[model samples]
Structures are given as structure tokens and as C-alpha cells.
Target: MLLPRGVPEAGRLAAFNALVRGDRATVCRAAEVPLLDQVDLLWANGWQPDDVLHHTRVALADAKQRRLVPDLVAADRAGRSTQAIDPRWQQQLDDAGLGDAQARRGWLARWSAREGLEGAQLVLAVLAVVETLRVPPLDFLLPPPGRPDQPLASAASAPDRADPVLVRVRRLLAKAESTEFEAEAATYTAKAQELITRHAIDAALLAANRGRNGEAPTMIRVRVDPPYADIKNVLLNVVAAATRCRVVVLGQVSMTAVMGTASDLAAVEALYTSLLVQGQHALAETARSAPPGARTRSASYRSAFWLAYADRLGERLREVTDHVVAGSTDSDRLLPALQSQADALDAWVTERFGTLGTSPVRGGWDAAGWTQGRLAGDTAKLATGDLRPTRRAIG
Candidate 1:
């Protein structure tokens, strides 16, 4: 049922139908080996559990097809010893809700039952996951589990979730995302950015003092959802810039490869996610209050709004970062460390993407929407005076 390459569409459909008519249990059992093999192969070839799951959700059409990727990933990881798995790998598994996969025996059967699949549906779901997993190798970003050289744990892991600074940042951003009042949201967001900036600087200084100057850049892909993915890419770029990271957007796959030190990468992802939500909310609110007969509902207006928001928000964030950096007492050591990371990251991006070209964003200009977006961004309360120093912002 794992449709081999070069099979004609008619032949494939016919084969599918024939299998649908056969004993489902036997077909499922037979497909399991190839499916799990494909999953393992993908992991070895630079795909991680979350990466595969995200791609499957985007590339596949059927709900059953989308739902099976993570289950298959869980099944594939069931035999691994906990000690052998990289912490980041395990984090991805847990994020994908597969942390207990090993503890659950006969997961496939249980997943089928839980999802209410039967007979043809079960067979088709298995085959769909198999087909989805069999893609070309991607750029190897991390050491896959089972590799002899895999670093099972490292300082690169995200700051502990329980860290008071991170906990406070998350809290502030949550309020920023959830609040309806623009001023209130902006205040919360500014503080969050302040905290993130301070945390990153602290991490950088710590790394510098530890003489970890040889650390190479690492990468992570953040998904860009559709309708205005191109505009969203602009927002991502701006956030990446302000957060001291770099990005290469592969628009075809709706993914952007972000390169930086581990801590900066984490900061970028967290802040970008919060800002995306806040931008979308502001856009929707604009749509509702737009003067009658305005083009606020048009694609051009929405695109222009996002463009302006990204432009303005980026300016504010850079100002905040600059203000904090200027306030740091350890500029002698801190500046060099930051400069080295940036230089190393630039080289890494050039080597990885080699001579990239710009991606043209779609949609015509909308003056009114652009104005509103800029205003909305300006309201984000990131004034230098308003930002609090988490111990001189970077001591």
C-alpha cells in the first residue's frame, strides 16, 4: 500500500481500491514496517519529529493524512532509550504529544481506535502517512537521535521554562496577546521585549565569560501560514533583525530558516509568535471599524497593513534593543561577543543559502490601511523611558 514511485495515477488508485477491499488488518500490519522505516529515514536525513508533523499538516489535504504523521513519529520513537535521545529531540516529541508513546503499547491500533478509523480509512491513513514521509533529504540542522555523535544534552536548550525571567516574559506576552486595549497590549509587549533583550544579553555575557567563543550558529524553521504568508515573512524578518538573528524564507514550503545562537533563536521565535498574534488582532479590528466603502477588506489593504505594521514594529523593537544595549555596563566584553555572533551567523547564512534573491511580495498598495498599521505600530509603547532594566538590561 506504500505506493512506489513511477506508478501511474490510475494504477495507484486501482491498487488503493484493491487494498481497500482486502483484509484491513493485514494491510495495516504490512504497511507498518515501510511507514516506520520511512519515518526513521527522514529523521536520519535532517527531519525532526515536529518538522515532519508541520510539513505533513501543510502538504497533505486529508484530515486523516494530517493526523497520522505525529502518530507515526511516536511509533517510530517507541523503542529508543530515554538516555539516548537528545533533549531537544525529546522536547519536540513532547511538544508533538508523543512523550508517552513508548509507555503506550500497540499505539497504532490504539490511535486508530481513538480516531475512530476502520477498514478502508485505517488502510488509507497508513498509506497517506507513508507517502508523506518519503520526501527528499533536507539540510541537516541537528544531530538526529541514534547518531553516535548526537549531543543528548547541551547548554543550547531553551532557558529553563521555570526561570523567573522567562516565566515573567511569557506572562507579559500572554497579556499582550490577550488584551483588547491597544495601549494596554503595547505596554505589556514592550516590557516583554525588554525582558527578552535583557535575557539574551545575559546569556551572551555568560557564554562569553565561559569562553564559549567557538559556538557555531544553529538553525530552526518557523512556519509561515498562508493567505498573507509573504507579508508575514516580512514581519518575521523584522523580528529576526531586532532579535539579533537572520532568516532565509523558503516561500515554496511556507518555512523560514532562522540562524543564530540557541538563546537568540529562542527569543526570536517567542517574540515573533506573540507579535504575529497581536498584528492579526489589530488587522481584524481595523477591518471592523474601517470607514464604509474603504478597501479595508481587500487583499491589498490587508497586505499593506501588514507591511506597515512590520516596518513600524521593527523600528520600535530596534530602538528598544539599542537603548538597552547602550545602557549595558559591560559594553567592552558584551559588544565584542555580540559582534562575533553576528559575524559568524552571517557567514553561516551565506554558506548555507549561497546567493539568495529577494522574494517579491504580492498585493498592491493601500494608503489608508498603511496609515492605520503604522499608527497601530506606533501605539506599541516601547519608549526608551518606559522599558525597565532587568539589572541594567545587560550587566
Candidate 2:
């Protein structure tokens, strides 16, 4: 039973007692039917394997519930033919460890034996997972994978494949995230920003030259988990802004829906991920030097620090993007193409999430932390130059 909110303790206990008295084997078998059905419903409603698993882990905060989800998803997917499965969708399933585990014929028994689950524990896990799968309709961020009428080729082919620009940028950002020295990290990050901005410009121009019938805009949901999720959302928002993307923060679910062309979305994801790593590192370093009296409010300090960092980095990244765009040899064409893309994307967002209300951020702030974070952001390198259009791109 999915416990409706605000159910009194006595009512809750009664439901639990009823479940406790049920025959365990029958319950498990019966539960699987609904669980598989819910998985199918969610897939159609735009919930992916990773998104559902993440919701279970964060919203439910139950390890048993989380463990049961992959098996349920994989088992449901087992019935679908390989040709019907999009490669990108398969990759998501693989990322969640659902690949190569589709042997669902005896999954219930195998899962029980593997986890040593039994009796009430097993029943609770099954029921919890079932309830978790009953997710409300979500906007189809990516095209639903198994739809017979939809074109899966575009979703499965070029967009999801490894693009050279992204591969190079990922390597640069990886160095930025791993390096200990602030200057070294900043240089790598700056280089990455330069590359991404240039690539975006080239892509836009190429699309324009091709009569603007290039890859259409799309969406991806990035998890902005808590321990200061609001501040982290700000960081993600800024990254999206600089990369010609828009983000709608779904604070209730600890997720952000980012909409953009595929390449730009990839850039935003990669850059935001690296920046978060760098921000956390800076937070730890600053924590070490905090005054003894101020240590009690570490949460406030971190919140302030990240907020300031996001604001400053937003300004810096935008500056780099502007500089690169201004220097483009094909600005006459590039500016209009970029503006047209932005307009189309704005219209799409308006249609998709009409009349969204702003969610107020709940947190404390520290002036000292803000100062430190601004300094960190100011010191971070973001160099860009020489944006002549490549012959290969335009030709």
C-alpha cells in the first residue's frame, strides 16, 4: 500500500498489520505484476532507469527499496525486443547495472536468495519498490525508447554517440577535477570552456549553413541532490546559461530539467560536473582555515560559499562565451543563428513548462564564506581567443 501522506499512526499500523498477516509467497508473486506494470507505465511517461533508481534512493532513503528497483526494471525490459530498444536507453540501463541481467524468468527467487531476504523484510522491500515505481507523469525529456511510431534512429545514432569535441572537453575537465593545485585546475577548466564555446559556435554555424535543419533541441534531467541542493542548482543553472541551454529546477524531486541542443547539453553536463568537484574541493580547503568560533555554522558557510561561487562563475563563464562569440569570423551569420536557436528553445520551454512558479531557497548565508568564494571564482582562469570559423565546419 502506498501510504498516503498525513495518515495517522493508528491507520498506518493497521495497514502494516494486514500486510504482516498475508501469505508471503502469494504477496511476492502478486506484487511483481504491479511492479512490472508500473515500470512500463513510467517508461512511457518519461522516467528512465537511472531517474527512477535515483528517486528511490533519495526520496525513499531505503537501501532495500533501491536494491529491488534495478531487477524490476531489467525484468520488465526483458520482454521487449532488442530492435525496439534504443542504444541510448540501453546505455542508461547498463549504467544502472541492468545490462546482462535480463534473465527475469526466476528473478524473484534469485533476488530473494541473493539478498537473503525473507518474510516481512522481503514483502516490505517488494511493496516499497512497487510504490516507488508509481511515479507521476514526467515530461518526456528524451524520446521514449520503445515507441513503435517514433523515430528512434535520431535518438540512438549521432547525438548519443561519442562526439570528438565532447571527448576532448571531457578529458580537459577530468584534469581540472583531479588536479590539486588551484592554478592547474583553473587552466584546465578554462581551456575546456574555450573549447566548448568554440565548438558550440561552430555547430550553430554549421546548422545554419545547412538551412537550420540540424539536430533539434532536447532535454536531460540532472540530479541536484541535497546537502545544499539549492546552491548546487544555482551552479547548474549558471552552467546551462553559458552553454546556450535552459534549466528548470525541480526542487521537489532534487532534479533539474535542462533543455538544449544535444552538443550544448553535453557541454553543460561535463562542465557543471567538473565545477562541482572543484567547488567541493575549495569548500574543504576553506573549511580548514575557518575561525574556531565560526566552525559551528559550517552549513551556512558552505551555502554562502557555493552561492557566491556560482554567481561569480556565471559572470566569468558568460564573459568567456561573449568574448568567443564576438571574435567569431562568421558573426554576421553566427549571431542570427544563435539568436534563432535561443528563440526556438525559449518557445519550447514556454510550451513545455508553462507558468512555473519560483521556489524560494531555504538556507543561511555567511559574509566571510561569500568573500572567500568570490575570490576563488575570480582566480579561476577562463581564457578564450581566436574564434575564426573552421573551413571544415563551414565547408
Candidate 3:
């Protein structure tokens, strides 16, 4: 029996105060009467009912805006039966200085629309309509219950805690014994190969060219047009990180001595693998969703990809820094070495494209050209022994 419209300003203030003081019951009680009833009571005292109703609704809306409705009944009723008030409701209520439940409902509706919930609902509706028209029988039965949970046995409770396959490979690489290193390396190599093969298969499926050939295509081609260099930059960053890690690992420059931890090699390997996996996923998703004759522009996809990479990089950097700060002999020297690698990577990235600060598509190619010129000049200088001021200095 609560008024479906608004509440009075004085009444709303009182209600709001009551709610703040944990006296929700009082507010709810006052709110329960119809607006007309309250207005009629007021009219008996020579007050205009219409004016009172308008003021009341405004006050009610204001109270609602303050989240002063503490009574579970009112809260539940509002949450369940009402959407949100619209801007119009707010505009109307603003003059009266009250709140309107209908206005709140309208506002919620608008919010849902902005969030694309309405689009989702439309999609569901279309699917339902299609089902009704073409496959009526699908609506006849509910889906079966999901798999039931099983009771854990003692063995399950004490499950084997062997390291992940990748971790095992890293440990094997760290061993001084050639035989041990070879064995673990073989396993790790096989796993990496398998992952690559699986990724190829997925790419083939996504391309929808499965039956055309006995084997999947080795290289998946993508054409990203101008104005989308962000995508390429992000991809390049991932590749650069992986390549640097691999070089450091394969070079066998005593990571513990340089980076302060042999474990850093394993961490780097893990990061490389993750980056590769994520790249493959991104490529696959792009291939699947891209429209026919679509050329990539704006590099928005790559930008999105880099945001995730940046997050991972930040986390890994923190872990590495923490290890160094802990005084771990193998970890303490890693920060400077990593910084050097990062610098090299930045140089490579700049040479390949341009500065990270520049526009991805507009300035990218020009940057790449400039980088190439610099590299050529350096190479020529190196070849002519021009790097050293004196010939003896080089010796």
C-alpha cells in the first residue's frame, strides 16, 4: 500500500534521518500510505493535494537517492519491482525536492542499456524466437543436472605434488649433469612442440580450412592495415620479451651470477611460454571474429592485448624485484641485468617500428625507416673500424 509515486521533503528528511539512525521501520511505515491519502489529509487543512503530491514524490526520490530505504520490505520491493528512475523523473522531482520510485526504475533501465544488457537481452530474444520457429522441441525439456561432486578419499587429500611439466623442464636445464639436462630438455622440448602443434590445429579450425589439406598451415597470415600499429607494437613487445628470455637461457651465461638466481631462468621461460600462448590465443580470436575483406586498422586489438601483457609484466617485475631485495645471491643481480635486457628490447622495438610514445599507425612506418637508417650508419661505422678513435684502442 506504499505510495507508488513520490514522498514529501520534510517527510523524506525525517525518513532519511530515521534510516541513518537504524530506524527503518518508521520510514517504511510512513511510506506505506498512498500519496492520495496523505494529500487528502493535508487538503483537509486547506493545503492543495496536487502540490503536496508533487512535493512528496520529489522528497521520496531524494530519500531513495541517499539510499535511506533501510527497511528490507521497501528495499526488496524496490529492487524487485522497480527498475530505476529516468532523467525526466529526476528533472520533475528536482523542483519538488523529492524522490520517485518510477524515476529510479527508469534510471536503472537506462543504465542497463548503456551497459549493453539490452543488447544481450535482444540477442536472447532473437534466439528464443528462432527456437520457437524452427526448433520448438528444444523448449520442451530442461537441461540435465551438472556432474555431481564426489567425496574426496584419503589418497585425494594427499595428492601428488609434482611440479608442473614446464617447471620440471627448468629444473632439468639447471642440472650440472649433461645426462640429466638432456633428459629434462627433451621432455620440455616435446611439450613445447606439442603446444605449437595444438595451436596450429586450432588456427586451422578457426580458419575453417580443415578438409582442404591433410596438414594444417604452418603460418597463419594476418594483414593489419594503417592506424592500428598499437596491435603490432603489443605483439612485438611479447615477441621481444620471449626472444630476450630465450637468448639469456640458451646463452648459458650463468644466470645466477648475472641475474642472481638460476631460478630466474625458469621464471623467464615460464613468462615466455605464457606470452606465446596469449599471442596465439589473440591471433586465433582475431582470425575467427574478423569480417571478410576486413583489414586491421586502429591497432585497438593489439592495444587491448598489451594492456594484459603489461599487467603480467608488472607482476613478474615485482616478483623479480622482491627476490633481489631478499638478498638471494642468485636474484640480487637480476634487476640491473633485466634493465639492460629491457633497454636492448626497447632499442630493438624502436628500430623495428618507432618510439612507444608516437601514434601507432600514423608515425610507425616513419619511425621504422629512421631506425633502419641509424642501424645502417652504425653497421657502416663498425665495418670501417670507425667506432674507435684510434686503431690501437680497438685492439
Candidate 4:
């Protein structure tokens, strides 16, 4: 078994020794185990919560003083008021890295009681704080695992290659995105989205039955590229979610690492590239109408527009997904397999980042740009087909 970083020295060495019965261990320099798992290990080995907290606090206080992210994950049911935490703590809860879901909602509620931001609002804040920590991973006494070694799957062998329906779907979206009329665009986009959604789900079921052909869950980094990397990041995130994958922006690099099965990854890349093209075109049109002297304001509006577009895409996808799911007769079998696939992909994320962290975005909203972007987003489609009359693709 692979133990994550930051385990107590004695227990870690014991586990390391256990793996030495002639079988090699593939350790990671940065992978992390769950916080509760760490907590349990400590307790089982004669350490108590008070001892755990004391050690964690001491470690965290030092990290905080050094202006580094703390390697601590607070017990979920525990109170989170900083008055009791080290007075020297500088970073707010929302800005810090904490782990993914903790098991204790009650602890979160109690922590929020003193601050008066209870329920969902407070829970979100606590989560944000937890999202920021990057606990130091335990060192591999042996050797670390190698980097992603496989070459990119060839486009010829890729999932989209033989699927002509997907080819049509892509063309429809490309046409839909370029159209002048919102109604025409929406109808084309929706139909295109519908086609892709059905295809993806169908592919998933096929893969599930094929025992996934030895394809384990994997992560692929897709570059959002820059100029408006932030805007592109938002688009990438929405596409990942729409495709049943998860994405994490890899800080200032203009790229995101997406977690999904290989098939879903292909779907995400194909759909996102097309959507991004459409989005950029829409933004260009938004820019054309910018009145003189409001350049800065117009830029802000464009930012807000893309953000709203991303938000709308998420909603639109869920609506389409629900429609697809409801219409399926085999959902009892289909849903579980899809869910199992989702859970497996999510595990890869946990192993990689330990705790996920994302910062809030601000400043995208010019009244003109906001309206245009939102309207454009509503017209954009994923894998859902809602056909209305439409002008054909432009020259």
C-alpha cells in the first residue's frame, strides 16, 4: 500500500518496512492520503486528538510564520475560529488549501456558529480554507514513480475517429456557433450537444462492458493558452464538468489538468476546442461594439461575459444530462457504472493534489458585454439537440 506524505516517522517507516518483503513500492513525491486516514493512523499508534492537534498546530504555526501554506487539515467537526488558532495566523480560511470533502459537516457547523456565517455560506468558506493546504508528502525511502510515460493516443486511434456521428456533431456546433441569429445558433448548438452527450454515454457503457480495455483513469493537462487565459480557464472548467470529468487550474500556467477516463478526456478536448473557438468569436463581436473611451470598461465586460457564459454552460449541461438520463430505460445499470467511473477518476485527483484549491475571479462585467456573453452562452450547445429552424453554416 502507498502511504502519502507527512505521516509520522515511526509509522511511516513501519509501513515502508512492510512493503520491503521483496515487492517494490511506487511512491509519489507529492501524492497525499486522506486527512482522516492520517488521523486514524496516529490514534491507532497511541496518539490522541489533543496530541494530533498539538503537533499539527506546531507544524502549521511554523508554516504560517514562514508565509507558506500550512500542511494541516482541521477535523471537520471542529470549530474554526482563528481566536483559538494561532494568533499569528495570517492567511484567511478562504485563501488557504484544505483537503477535498471532510466527513464532518457537524464540526463545520459548530466552527461557523461563532462567526455567524452558518449553513452553506459558512461551510463553503471553511471548505475554501481547507482547499488551500498542501501537506508535505512523505518521502519515498525507495524511489518515486516515473512521470506519465505513454505517448498521446493517436487521433486516428482516438475515440472520435471512427464515430461519424461525432464528426457531424462537431460540424453542427461549429456552424451553430458561427451563425448570426441567436435562435439558429441555439438550436444548432443544442442539437449538436445532444448528439455528443448520447454518444459519450454510449461509449462509456461500451467501455464499461469491455472491462475498460485495461485503461485506468488518467490525467491530461490541456493548455488554455494565454492573452485571456483566465477566460479560457473558465471555459475549460465548464467543458470538463459537462463531459463528466473534473479540472483543476495549474496556477498561472495557462493550463488545466483534467481527470477522466480516456474516452471522456477525448470528448472534453474535442468539445472544449470547438466551444472555445465559438466563445472567442463571440467575444470579438462583443469587442466590435465597444464605444470609444470605455476600452477598460469594455474589457471588464468581456471578462464578465465569459464568466457568465461558463456559468450558463454548466447549467445547460445539467439540464441536458437530466433529460438524457431520464429518457434512458437502462439507467439503473447505466448510472451505477457511470458513477463508479466518476469515483475512480476522482480518486486520481485526491492522490495528486490532496486538497484542491481555486481562487475567486473578479472584474468581468461591462453591461453590454455581460448581456452579449450570457445570450451567446444560452445559445451554445454541448451534447443536447433541441432543433429549431436554422440558417446553414456560414461561408
lDDT of each: 0.76, 0.75, 0.30, 0.54
Query: Which residue runs does candidate 3 get wrong by more than 4 Å?
Result: 1-232, 235-274, 282-303, 310-314, 317-395
lDDT of 1 by residue, 53-168 (tens): 77888878988667666677777777665537767778888777652356324666666767788678877778767766667666665678778584422324444567677677
TM-score of each: 0.80, 0.84, 0.20, 0.54
lDDT of 1: 0.76
Q: Per-residue lDDT of 1-395 in model 3, one digit per residue for the tens?
A: 22122687777565445444433333223433332233223323322212323223333323322222212112222342433433332343345433234422233233223334333232232222222212101100111112112111111111112435334433432331222222232233323323322332332333333333222101111122222334333333333233232121101111110111122233343434443343334344444676764432223444443444444433433333333234334333443444444454445434433443433322222333233222211211111122222221110
Which portions of model 2 show Cα errors greater than 4 Å?
1-18, 81-83, 99-106, 109-120, 141-146, 150-161, 209-215, 288-297, 380-395
Per-residue lDDT of model 2, residues 1-41, tens digit only: 43344799988777666656666555556566666777778
Candidate numbers, best lDDT first, in rank order: 1, 2, 4, 3
Q: What is the overall TM-score of model 1 with all chains considered together? A: 0.80
What is the Cα-based TM-score of model 2? Answer: 0.84
What lDDT does model 4 reach?
Answer: 0.54
Measured with C-alpha atoms, the lDDT of residue 80 in candidate 2 is: 71
Candidate 1's C-alpha runs over 4 A off are 7-18, 81-83, 98-125, 139-143, 151-165, 198-216, 251-253, 288-295, 326-337, 388-395
Please count the clashing residue pairs in each candidate, in the order shown. 0, 0, 35, 25
